[model samples]
Target: MSLTDSEILLLEQLIHDREVDKLFSRLTTITEETNPNYKLLFEAINSQKWGFNDKNRPVV
Candidate 1:
């Protein structure tokens, strides 16, 4: 799928903010195999809301 300027900007920002690294781990050559941690990270990023309170603040 093609991405718009805003999407690209957000992606760039995500990287700049170090959110991307926290989202996905090492790149995989084979789609069938990947680190389970990466999957968990992906789910966390896409989840509706972060499982934490503002005052407590959870580590990403």
Candidate 2:
């Protein structure tokens, strides 16, 4: 699925604006896994998971 220039521009703008939720909503059904913004989107989605220590370890 090739995105037109306008779509590319919007994606870029979303990345620039850090509009993660809006971007994620728009990208939900995307077929282009290699889209350049994918990494940025994935990072944005996972950005808040870095400080979690819930590793599911059993406690005595």
Best prediction by lDDT? 2
Tens-digit lDDT string for candidate 2 (22-55):
6767666446655868767866776654343478
Q: Write model 1 residue lDDT over 7-59, tens digit each, in one string.
A: 99999997777865644544423244766777676666677565667788864
Inter-residue clash pairs, candidate 1 = none
Candidate 1's C-alpha runs over 4 A off are: 19-60
Span of 10 residues, lowest total lDDT, candidate 2:
51-60
TM-score of each candidate structure, all chains considered together? 0.30, 0.30
Q: Indicate the residue-level lDDT of 3 in model 1.
A: 100
